[model samples]
Target: MTSSTPLPPEGHGLPQEIIDTIIDTVSDSTTLKACTLVRHDWLPRARQNLFCELSFPPATLRGEERWRSDYEEVLRSVVMDVAHSNIKPPLSAAVRRLKLHFTDTSSELGFLEITSQLPFKNLHAIELLDSDLYRFEDHDQDALFLFLRENPSLKELRLDGVNSEPKKFLHFFSRLAGLQLQLRSLYLNDFFGYHDDYHEPESTFLHSLPLLSNPPALQTLALHDVSRTEADIFVIPLLTTPSRFFDLSCLQSLEFKFPFIESDEAILKMCGATVMRFTIKGIAHRIHDGVILEKCFHHLSNLVRLELHSVHPDRHGIVLLLLEHVPILRRLGQLSMQFVKAPSRVRDSSPPYTSAEWALFGEGVDSKVDQLMQTSNPSLKHITLDIPCSWKNVTEERIREYFPKTNSKAVLEVFRIQDS
Candidate 1:
């Protein structure tokens, strides 16, 4: 019998770069853990990939309370390991993003406090989902403020389904000012801050912030499903007037959802001159007749890219109206339109379009495409249509048949999206 071939030296087989690329593409946690045992040089990259994003209760749990306790225990164990282990280039330094959930439970609040004490040196992004900021005690608030103050590298913050009183909200922003943290992007969705009747005091306090005189520059902002009253009291002043919270002149991208209101028009006018990309969502069929819609597009003079999402049935006229306003956008280059199915509750209320309606809609869009191409100094280049998978066949066939000129130019693209 022959002797077994001797093993190659550690880290001697694959080049380091190639091994790093392979580890980067491994999405399964089990496989990534196995990679850590391969060799010493491979440990750093594998650990970085494994800890880059830490989600409490893991997003996969998705509010299943039964699995939450077990998941939390696992998270605590991992954090303890990182804190006590002697691994080189400690796991704490690899964490770049954190997704945390805040609830009313005492145990959950304690978890948040524990998370704030961790040493995350390179963290840059934080997302808080379904948070109840009003319920936070003084200690809880201090923990969050301390966390933000410690992470100077943080640049993005997102709050979804967050509920707070106007005073508490202002205090949150005030704390951010005290830290002098410069954020690049901010997103607020379904954020509730009481009713419109309280606008006076809220507005007064918001304008009185000392930092309002020298607000930091922000690059991107998004507001979705926020009530008009909340916008008037909280958001409009931050964008329309000079505030130490955000400098609208420096904003480059904006995403706004519909039911166009007066406050939104004011924001567009202030930020439109510099905004290069804009996205409008929740467009209903009834909004095509709104005068506010016409005025809003007029201010986007410098817009280069536009996206229209969740367009309702028989609302094709809105697309035509939008393009008419685009002649002013000499820099316009790309346009994307997304069509989605109505929600289950409203599906019965809004029926799907028949073949006749689709034919008429296609013809109207085809004509608009031709008109846009004929404009002088036409910068238009690409157009994308995203249709739900259920309507993929019918919508794609009709679009191809009617958009002959667009097809000939080879600038049109179609994609199928999941129904949900």
Candidate 2:
């Protein structure tokens, strides 16, 4: 007699390669877990994909928690296991990205040692976020220098609350000059102060960055606070090097969040029409002007997204000027304006000039924005208007009226009266 036909396999039983593709597309961790249970054959592929990104909450110390006492006992037992050394093998082999967050100075060296043991040769990206950083003592500085020297294959580097003498930063960067590691992105956040608290030799480390023998293949550079002065001699190297980056075609995003007292011309020229995303924060009135920015936009016709913060009303004329000058900006997808309050005068008028106020806002800002939208750029999508919470003169009604409704089906949103 013929045997009963076997039941059809459960699910599609997708090929192993197709499963791997599905894993790669997912960015959220929760979804990865569900995928793992699909089948025994899919387990290894799911695990490898999920563990590729390792995030360390470095702020938590070894003995900070009372519960950790029990944890430590268990941890020690696991470390002493016969196969403990093999633990790094599978993890290191799959990890391509690492995000580290540290809160204390005491654990800096310990953190370094832990990272050194990890297999980082295949690592491509690293993001460092430190809530509290130690003012580098002599030894701490040396250890950091050594860590960078060892991790020469790094393609992307991000740092937050990193403290060091400017000279030391330059000294460390100088060593990596010849390696020419494929560094495509650089992000740095440092405490901004008017004075130089940490002293170093006369040889300023800030200048030494551009002088590196072979600049890393940088495509995206973000500097939160590099300097405070308006001196061109100091700001030129950082702002004027887009063309120099390897595969200049890849350079698209640039950010200058520091307080700079200098010209925007070089920055405009360096971008030279190809820059797509640009962000500028903390502008000092005396050093920069609207006209320069207008010219910059003229040159950088490709800019698609712009974020402007801490700008004075007088400087607003610049953004308006830019809207008129940059033809390509009509395609701008997102625009954010972070405005500071204009000092108020005690107006004793009986009735507030409601009509005048509306007219003024409409003629000045609203009209300019409408004109920009009329331009042919199809990409202009979202606009966020951030105004001080205390500005009583610009009422909610006036703001709503100023933002003309577009037929784009909320594809372009306009927000007003954001919290200061």
Candidate 3:
């Protein structure tokens, strides 16, 4: 009776596994910030969410910082402390993917220079969009190289919306050829914005080889808005056969997104055994004519994903379409599609035979599925469709209505391409 009441039983916290599951589900930044602040244990998970996709807002920092007059401004410390080594490891170490998006000729080029040089050992992927930082005349380019050299862990590199000439573009290949690590995925889109409109009489860059004496390690190589002739004559030959030297056998997924498909199907066939994913997006008249696929695809018995999508935005919109890059697949997967040449205009977009357009799209889709049956039996299945029309005639709703139902043919519920 004199004994004090037994102390209330201690309550153990949730199991660590369960706590991680809870943290993983909450994806929003604001909530993640709150979760990190709540306790130190949760900080690791929260920081992972926050820093994993460290994307700089593209438009917000587009223009230059206005000049300030007072000495007080100097003391304010305008230098970004983001990538500094002094920053907390919990934040810096957690970063896995970094996407730095900017506009053309932006004034804050210095910001990009400083932020990119920071050391983050765990960084696995980097995407630089819409910035011409590759200009060798600038220090920022050197800084970018330094950052790349430091991050040996990088698995993927995507350079999209970069506008430069062929000679400047070749420099990128030359540098990448020197990297020690094998990249799982490399996507180059409009790197020059070099269009048929300019139509240079001679693409001298193709005739010349990259400075690399050896091939760069690559699993997935996607070329967008690049010239068809150059890809066949220069890039492919130099990379694959290399003029009586070693073959670039590292390629697994190879894609081309030029305005037209020329007689390069043989190059694709040469890599057929190793190339799991094959994609081509553009007018695709060659594919529609049936010669390209007939000649190229039958050889790729191990091919997993085959995506042929329209590239013209007015008639079609494919954002990295057809190439659903599974960086680690190096992760095998399956896919297929046929090609169709449809005019961008149909009697001034009055929805003329909305069914016909759907019919044509369906035919292309169904044929691809059939063609891949032998090759991609064990590959990952993904159908990415680029929505090129901005509702000029048919709405997104209208497009969805005619999609094929592939449920009976395979495990796939739909035979059609799904918008991502």
Candidate 4:
């Protein structure tokens, strides 16, 4: 009688799941290949786990053939290997997230084509980072658009460190809207690198986007280093009202970085929104004085949270703005500040105690926080100040001298009520 012998477990008698897990986290390709050879049963699992996110090393293909043949072969192999695998579905279907990370080397069209083949219908999120695809022709941009359009499950899209023409940027927005898909979050940072042809202002682009009949279901929008030099004045009025386009509603959260917030006019226009959360970043140099801030924040009566980022001590104007405008400050739930460098030579400046500068710049940073409580921000519970400072910087020490250790009786009472 021939007895049936059971096959031994794969990978040192461990099960496939454990082997898969190990393969999933392994970063070294040589080590992974060695592990795969441990058994035939382990091969499929190991390959799936390992090559699901394949990154080509330029060192593997060097010389004249690098351009004409090797790049294409490597890319085509990676895509076909992942897409045609019988062990599972397309890599995109299984991939919840994908990141196209490029090191300090030039990548060819082969890489772009591989990305284009990636099944986008199942990708929940994707980030395109630090790529040197400088000045792709319209055809390349259209291919990317085709991918985005087909990505029904994609909810978040982030494009960072991409250098392209302004027309390409506009094309991206147009394609996204044309697809009429649902995307909850979108972040574009340095999408258009310093293009000299962008001689106009930032507002110009802002005003035009909303007019699109089919904007995505964008709940959160963030733009950084997007020069507002051309931001049209009409955009201010356009964003002030709540509007809906396709799946995208009025933005629930908005963040503006750098030069966009440099003008109180822009700030005032944005404050008109009934948005639940608002984050502003800029220098205190342009907020003018307390009076202007008051006017600017007047429309933010419904603001549930306010985050401020400024670099100057003159932000005492900001304190007054908060105190006067956020009277329902008790209703405010969150406050944050991203502070820049502190001023030098305390003694060389105004009286630390009497100055509004002290309130904004000096010791009792906490007590000044108390004044914000007079408003209805009763729900206020979280406060965060991401203060990046140097250890040897005396400015931090000088500024800490006035931080109020205690809140006002009214604020304490509100805390009590909320806690109860």
Error of 4 at 181 (Å): 2.4
> Per-residue CA lDDT of candidate 2, range 1-420, in tens?
432443327644555555668877773478778766755555666666776776653335543653233433333343244124464336655667777655454343344444444444456777766532334444544554455555656688787766543344434444444343567887766633222554543335444445443456567767676554422333343435432323334567877762332444565565546777888776434444556555566665777788877755544444555455545565577777666664454223223335434323432655576555554556777666676665656665555565565323353443445444
CA shift of 4, model 4, Å: 38
The local lDDT score (0 to 100) that residue 81 gets in candidate 1 is 75
Candidate 3 residue lDDT tens string, 185-291:
77777744343443444335444544445544567777777556445433454455433222446578788764335434655656667887777666433234334
Best by TM-score: 1
Evaluated against the true structure, the overall lDDT of model 3 is: 0.53
Segments in model 4 whose C-alpha atoms lie over 4 Å from true places: 1-81, 84-91, 101-111, 130-134, 191-214, 230-249, 258-272, 281-296, 309-331, 338-364, 375-420
- lDDT tens digits, residue span 1-420, model 1: 432443347524765556778888994388878767866567778878777887776767757775555645655676687688776667678888888765446345366577776767678888888887767677878887788778888888889988877666766766665564477888898888854345456557766776655665778888998877787777775566455466778789999887678877888888878888999888764554357776777788878898888876555666677667667677788888787763333212222344533523543655675566556328888778777766633566666655676667888887878875
Better of 1 and 2 by lDDT: 1
How far residue 61's Cα lies from its native spot in candidate 3, in Å, is: 5.4
TM-score of each: 0.80, 0.62, 0.62, 0.58
CA error at residue 154 for candidate 3, angstroms: 1.5
Work out candidate 1's RMSD over C-alphas.
Answer: 6.1
Candidate 3: which stretches are off by over 4 Å?
A: 1-14, 21-40, 57-79, 83-90, 106-116, 138-140, 193-215, 229-234, 241-247, 258-260, 263-267, 279-289, 307-333, 336-406, 415-420
Q: Between 2 and 3, whose lDDT is larger?
A: 2
Pitting candidate 3 against candidate 4, the one with the higher TM-score is: 3
**Residue pairs with backbone atoms closer than 3 Å in model 2 (clashes):** 230-261
Over 4 Å off, model 2: 1-11, 38-40, 58-89, 107-114, 131-153, 193-213, 225-227, 230-250, 258-265, 280-289, 305-367, 376-420
Best candidate (score: lDDT): 1
